[model samples]
Target: MLMSPTNRLQRLADDSSANSLSHRLRARRFQLFEQLIGGLDRPLSIIDVGGTNRYWEQRGWAGRDDISITLVNLEAEPQVHANIQPTAGDATDLSEHADDSFDIAFSNSVIEHLFTVDNQAKMAREIQRVGRAYWVQTPNFWFPIEPHFLVPVWHWLPESTRVAILRRRGVGWAGRTPDADKALRVIQEHRLMRRSELAHLFPDAKIVGEKFGGLTKSWTALGGFPALDRVTA
Candidate 1:
């Protein structure tokens, strides 16, 4: 059965649109998890650090005894879902738990939220300390600062200049230093890590996959994400 050129063109257009849409949605899902934990399947021990996550409770993403979840926050456990255990703690210090505590430790845009580079490193160590493997998501520094972590890794800039620029842009103003600490509170999101940065952090840990992350626009290959695959010791 031969088709007309018009039908062929339409089919091509539809196929292109569908492929583009699927790609966009996949990237968006990663971004959403950077803000909140969702879309993961199965019942398992999931630990979220340093943010508010209510998706499992509302959506019932849990899979029974095979999966359990907890939130390690900076404050007392909130009165909420019976399944979620919110614990008062810091990401850097999880001394409260024994070795190899949880199956998956998750944090999105969290490390840059730390007050200092040292603090961020400590948080990373602790995450490695507890979980089997981690799914730590942040932004690529080359982009602009919409949520936080400063597109282009503004942390490397002179504090004065960074402040002035963000100030003019109506960010990190009001006498607040526009660092990762401020980002954690203000933007609630952040830039992803650079290639070198991720390598240094993970060190011996294998990097399974990475994706270019963004909101609604195109992201260069260099400005994508670093999704991890790990073999727990």
Candidate 2:
């Protein structure tokens, strides 16, 4: 049996070469958002679905007291900071919040886990309803390497073969879960999006591509950029 590649997330935590290129790409993506939101002079209200305060902190924005961040996740996060509010809710159904209640509805690396296109659509609609603008992102299916597994052409393989590979030597972060059944679950739970699908979800939004080694690795739908005046630094 072929051994799986080491888990990429663990490698990321250790700052391994495997994750360095991808991390740099991700950082650039965040910078793009920062520049896009630079025009706003007042405090920004942000609703982050499937996010945590730690995530904001990691982004180096948790200390920005001027920004009010509400995080909505399926699992409740411990209240670790006053500036960040944590709430438990489903991304697809955010009826508790009024329409346009937030300046931005942001999510990252989440849509693929929704397991169905309908669920993805529902989440997109809710994001639109709750926020005046939004930034939603997901991995690009056409990328040669699968972001989750860090395996080239892994996602395009047959299910049984994929399961067998996971059962033996699992690769990437999903492979780190030694249990084959759990790995199978991880494989089944994700569905990467194509450019067309992403465009369809947020029709009015500007579609930004995140490139890795000159290949489009992911895409972000930025809903509010068109309405903002280009900011001069």
Candidate 3:
């Protein structure tokens, strides 16, 4: 049987698929991340906001003694790697950690899930405060296809329309729900961001566009990296 577009897109996004576009892009992103932190001679400490043990495992960084990673999420994840520490925390307020407590604060495709601009700002602020350097990636609002829904122009439609669509059938990672309240909540949860908003949030950082098919797909806000000029240029 042929797979639906949503299923096809979701399969392409799975980290285990080595040949997937999302995996390849993520690998490239990690290479850039390594370049950003390559200059440091000592063991590196990183705090991954909304990260997972499997994410690091897939990236081949799970058990490396040269670096340690703290995975933070709403609920603590199970610890399966010696070098990875799982912690329960709120992204909007990371007061549990002191200023510049980590070498780098990393997040991927997590900022938009905050549901509001104010919450996004708070998370951005907390990220900057807790780490000397930060790397944040989010889907570009102007991208023709919404990454979550696997639907073209889905994000640009009216909220009522989006809710109605979700009510009818499953879209990407989200399953079909007959409940209007649940569908509306699902539609409102993901708020794709524009370049201007990211720039405003990280004024000191360099914004680099991740392009596909000559169009900007996502944006990464990078700060305090010595190779910023080389990478951005």
Candidate 4:
């Protein structure tokens, strides 16, 4: 059966299959993450902002005695592993965690969902304050395709045009929300970041680009880690 463009993109975004593009890219990203922290001799504590237990479990980090992972989201997720702890919190305000409380503050594809650049900056500040080291990733604004919508040039379209498109049909992760206002709200929630913006947000961090077909697909701000020349994804 032939898959539509929307369906094909949704499939590519799915992380359930080890063979999926998202999973493969994430696996490669993890390798770089491991290298950055592997030299440490002590047990590691990680506070994952807007993260899930499934992410760590898939990477075989769950239930490890040497690592403790605290998953933070708007609502606490169901507990599935002893080493993984779920907590309800806002990414923009991680006030519950003390300064340098976690060995690493990690987030993946989350900064862009904050609805505004101001909120994104708040999250970046909080992440830096709470963890001794941090790693944050977001979709690249220059990428030809809008990852969330699975639409080519969707992010480049004007506000009214994006809303109209969303009201007509289901796209990637979002279903058709006939209400114009609701569709507009959904469109406003996702704001991709450019390399310069990321660098400005985390001035202390090194900006790493995740590339596909020689074009950068996403950006990662890496802070307080040993300098590495490159990480190919």
Error of 4 at 13 (Å): 1.5
In model 3, pairs of residues that clash are none
Q: Could you arrange the candidates by lDDT from highest to lowest? A: 3, 4, 2, 1
lDDT of 2 by residue, 116-202 (tens): 899999999999999888999899999887777777888899877788888777567664556767867878878899989989999
Worst 10 residues of 2 by lDDT: 9-18
Q: For model 4, how does the per-residue alpha-carbon lDDT over 80-101 read when each residue is reduced to its tens digit?
A: 9999999999999998889999
Tens digits of lDDT, candidate 3, 1-233? 99977778888876678988889988987888888888975699999999999889988999999999998999999999999999999999999999999989999999999889999999999999998999999999999989888888999999999888889988877899789999988888899999999999999989999988999999999998777778862
Over 1-233, each residue of candidate 1 has an lDDT whose tens digit, in order, gives 99854344344323125354333443454554333323344455667786454444433443346566777888956746555777889888988976667767777556666655567678778777777656665544444432332234455566556545554454322235456456344433333455456556656554323333532222211111133221211
Number of clashing pairs per prediction, in order: 13, 1, 0, 0
| Model 1 weakest lDDT span, ten residues long | 216-225
Number of clashes in model 2?
1
The TM-score of predicted model 2 comes to 0.86
lDDT of each: 0.52, 0.80, 0.91, 0.91
After best superposition, candidate 1 residue 15: deviation in angstroms?
Answer: 29
Order of models, best TM-score first: 3, 4, 2, 1
Instruction: Give per-model TM-scores.
Output: 0.58, 0.86, 0.97, 0.96
